[model samples]
Target: MVESAPVAEPAAPVESAPERVSAPASEAAASIAPAPTPAPDLDPGTRRGVPPVAAPQPSSVPPVVESTPAVAGTAAAASVIPGTAALPVTGGDALVLRGVTKRFGSTHAVDGIDLTVPAGTFYGLVGPNGAGKTTTLSMIAGLLEPDRGTIHIGGVDAAAKPLAAKRLMGVLPDRLRTFDRLTGRQLLYYYGVLRKLPPAVVESRTADLARAFDLEDALGRSVSDYSAGMLKKVMLAGALIHSPRLLVLDEPFEAVDPVSSSIILDILSAYVAHGGTVILSSHGMDLVERVCTRVAVIVAGQVLAEGTVAEVRGELTLEQRFVELAGGLSDVEGLEWLHTFSD
Candidate 1:
C-alpha cells in the first residue's frame, strides 16, 4: 500500500524575503556542497509503504557512439521506412533498442545507442542538455525513426509493426500540445477513441482520471484556458486513459506545482507497483534518486553507465556521479572578476 502523500510545503510569501549577504566564492561552494547521499532507508517507495524491489545488477556493456540522420515527423503518424531491419528480442524486457542512431544535419543527436528496460522497472534516463536523451526517447516511442537499428516494445518491432507496438505504451514527450478547442474532458475522450477504447469504457476512465488529476471542476472548460501545471496534468491523464503497459515521459515534473508533483509521483509509484514500466528523463537528480529503481547516465549520445541507483552512484550522490560521468567537476577559471558589492 502506498503511504499517503505529505502535504506540500507552501511557498513563503514575498514580504518574508531576507536581505542578501556577500560571501566568498570558496564559502559559496562550501555552502552548496553536494548533499550527503540520502540514506537508503528513506527511499520514497519505501516511505510510501511499498517494499522496494531489489534493483538488478549493472550491465557490463561498454558505451559506444555511432552517427546517422534524424527521421522526420511525429511518432504517432510517421511511416516506417522500407528495408529497416527488425531485431529479434529475447527475455521479457519491456523495451529494447539495438544500435539506434539519429542525426540532425551534421550533428549526430543519438548515436548507436543500445538500451534494455526490464518489465515493472521504474527507470530514469539522465543526461546533459543536447545529449540525445530526447532523441533516443522519440525513436523508442515511434515518433521518429532511427537511420540504423531497431526498436521493440514488448517484443513487437516498432519499425515494422508500429501500431501493434504503440498500443502497449503511453508517451508524454518534453513538449505536449492538446487541441485548444476541446474541453479537458473532450481531449481525453479523443485520445481514448484514438486508442480504440470502447465509448462506455472511455467515459468511465475519463471520469476517474479527471478526479484523480483534480480537474473535475475544469473538465468542461476549454483546455486552452488551463494553467501550465493543469495542462501537464490533463496531458498526463490522456496518456493514462488507455492503461498502457509502459510509459515514456520526458520531464514530467518540470513546471508543475509541488502538490501536483507529489500527486504524479504517487500515481507513477502505484502504476509501477501494479507491474507497469516507466522510463522518464529529468534534470532533477534528487527526484530521480528518490524514485527511480534503475538509471542510465548518458553523455555525448552514449550511455556512460547503466544500473540501479545505488550501483551506479556507489558512495556518491546521483548528481555527483552524473557530473563526474558527463564532465568531471572542475574549479571555475577566468571568473575572478565576480564580486559582491554593497552601498
Candidate 2:
C-alpha cells in the first residue's frame, strides 16, 4: 500500500495560507498500475506562429523564446499600466499589480512594484538571486498575501474574488513541494478534481500529459521516487492538467533534460498562441531573449527596466543589459587568497 497524505496541490483555493510540502527521499517499492483510459477531450491547445524557443542545453533547460514586436501576442486591448515599459500595450488583462509590497520581519522582500501581463503573451521575469522575483510570483499565485497593494486577475480583484481568480490560473511554484506519497497519477487526479473537473476528463488529460512529458512509465510510481528532473516534469504535468487561462511558472526548466525542456517550450508556445497567457521567472537571459514577448528586470525589489525584448535589450543583448542594470561584475580581489594556495 502507498503512503497517504493530503495531496498538496499547486495554488489550490485554500482559504488560509497555502500548505507547502517538504519532499523527502524516494521509496523503493511501487506498483505498475495502468493509467485510466484516455479520450480526445484533452486539448493542449497547440498552434503555430508562436514564440521561438532556445536550442537545447544539457545541464540547464530554458524555454526562452525569441519574440519580435510583431509577434501578435495576447489581446492588447486591456488597460495600460501606470509606468509599463515602452511597448505597444496590447492584450486582454491577464494579471495586474499596483504598489505591491511584501516584507519578512524587517527585510523588504518586495518593495512597491507594479506589473501588467496581457492575456496570450509569454512574459518573463528576470532578476539576480534574492531579487524578490519569487516573492512577487508567490503573491501573484495567491500563495502569499501582499502587505499592501491591489492585484487583479483578468479584471477580477484577487482579494475580493480569490477563488474566481484562482480558477483562471494554473501555478507551478518554485520547488517540488507537494504530496510525494501518492502516485503521479493520483496526484494529478487530485489536482484536477480539486479544480472540479470531471473524473473522465482528468483521466484523459493525465494520459495525454504523461505522454507529452514522457512520464507514461513513471505515472504509477510515487512522486517521492521521482528524480529532480522527473519531479519537475510530474509537477508540471499536474499544473497543466487543467487548461487554465493563465499559467504562473517559476523556474520551470530547472533540472529538466534538454529534450524535455524543448517539449515544454513547444507546449507553452502553442498554449500562448491559442490565447492562454504565461508569466514565468528565469535566469537564462538568452532564453528570455528568445522566448519572451516582454520582460521585466527586477533588482533590489524594484524593476529596473520593462519592455519588449527588442526595447529592453536596446543595442546590447539581454544578458549585457541585465548585467549593466545589475551593477556589473564585482572585483575578484577578495578571493585572491584562494588563488595563492599554500603549496
Candidate 3:
C-alpha cells in the first residue's frame, strides 16, 4: 500500500510549461524583403497574359498617307470647265441643253430651258401653234443659236464646237425643201453623201428604208410626182440613211397616212431601243401623250410644264390639262360651216 501511494504522488508532481508564441513583424520590415525574381523579359506594367508596354510616340508627328495627283488634277480640271454645272453627262445621247434661251429681237422664242435626252429615249416636244417648241429644238439641232445657254451632243459642245455636235444629229425641218427633180432613191443617196456615210452603209440603209416605208415602187419616180404622204415617207427615209445617233423631226406625222404613221412609230420605237435618240416636235398631243416617255410643253415661248404625261396630268386627263395650260381650242371648235350638209 505504501509503494502504490508513492508512485501516484510522483506522477502528480510532474507539471507542463505554457506553449511558446511567435511574434508578428511590422509592415515596414516585411516590405524590406526582396520580391521573387520576375519571369524573363516580363513587363512590370503588364499583368499575367497581357501584352508588353508599347514604345512612347512623339506628340508632334503627323500621320502618313498616299497622294493621288492624277485624280486630284482631273477633279480640279473638271471643276474649271464651263457648263460643268449643266449635268454629269455620260453615254451617247444626241442632245442636251441647260438654261437655253433664244430671242429673235424682242420675241423670246425659247426662255431658260433645260433638257436632257438619255440615249434610247423617245422624247416629245409639244406645244400650241406659236409655242417655242420648234425654236428650242432648232437650237438643239444646231440650226439656230441660243442667246444664253449650252448645248451638248454626244458630249460635244454645240456652241463652241458646232461641227462635231452637228455630226451626231440628223434633222428634218418643219418645212423641208428638196430637189423636186431628184427621184426618191436619189434624194436619199444625196443626203447620205452629205452626211459622209460609207457607200455600203448608205446603200444597205436606203434599200431597207425603201422596203420598210413601202416606197420601193415610188423610188424611181421624181419627188414632185409623189403624194404628200409618200413625200413624207421619202424624207423620213432620207433623214435616217446615215444612222445618226440623234434624229430630230418637226411634225413627222403631219401628212402621213394612218398605216404609214403606225409603221413610222414602230420604226422610231425600234431606233430608240437600239441606243438611238429621238427628239420630235408635234401638235398632235394625243399621239405625243401615247408614245412619249418624257415631254416638254411650251406656251408663249416659255415652258409651261414638263414631265411624263401621267406626271403632268396628275388627276386631270391629258387633254383637259393641255386645254387648261395652253388655252382651250374653243375658237377652232366654234366653226359651224363644216357641219352643214350640201343641198
Whose TM-score is greatest here? 2
Local accuracy of candidate 3 as per-residue lDDT tens digits, 195-265: 44344544555665676677879988877799988977777766665445677788889989998888777
For model 2, how does the per-residue alpha-carbon lDDT over 1-343 read when each residue is reduced to its tens digit? 0011233433332110001111110110010111111122222242111111111112321111111111112122111112212122235778999999999899998899999988778999998999999999888877788999999977878887665566566677776556666788877776655544446655655766776677889998877899989987777766665555678888988888887787777767756665667899998888889999999999989989998989999999999999999999988878977987795
The whole-model lDDT of each prediction reads: 0.62, 0.64, 0.58
lDDT of 3 at 332: 67
**What TM-score fits each model?**
0.72, 0.75, 0.68
Show pairs that collide, candidate 1: 3-48, 69-103, 70-103, 75-142, 75-143
* Candidate numbers, best TM-score first, in rank order: 2, 1, 3
lDDT of 1 by residue, 1-343 (tens): 0011121110000000000101221221111110011111222232211110122212221111111111111221122222222122223788898898888799988888889999778899999988889888878776677899889877778777655566566667666544656678776765655544445655655665666667889999977799988987887776666556678888889889997787677677756654567899999999999999899998999989999999999999999999999898677887676765656
The all-Cα superposition gives candidate 2 an RMSD in Å to the true structure of: 14.7
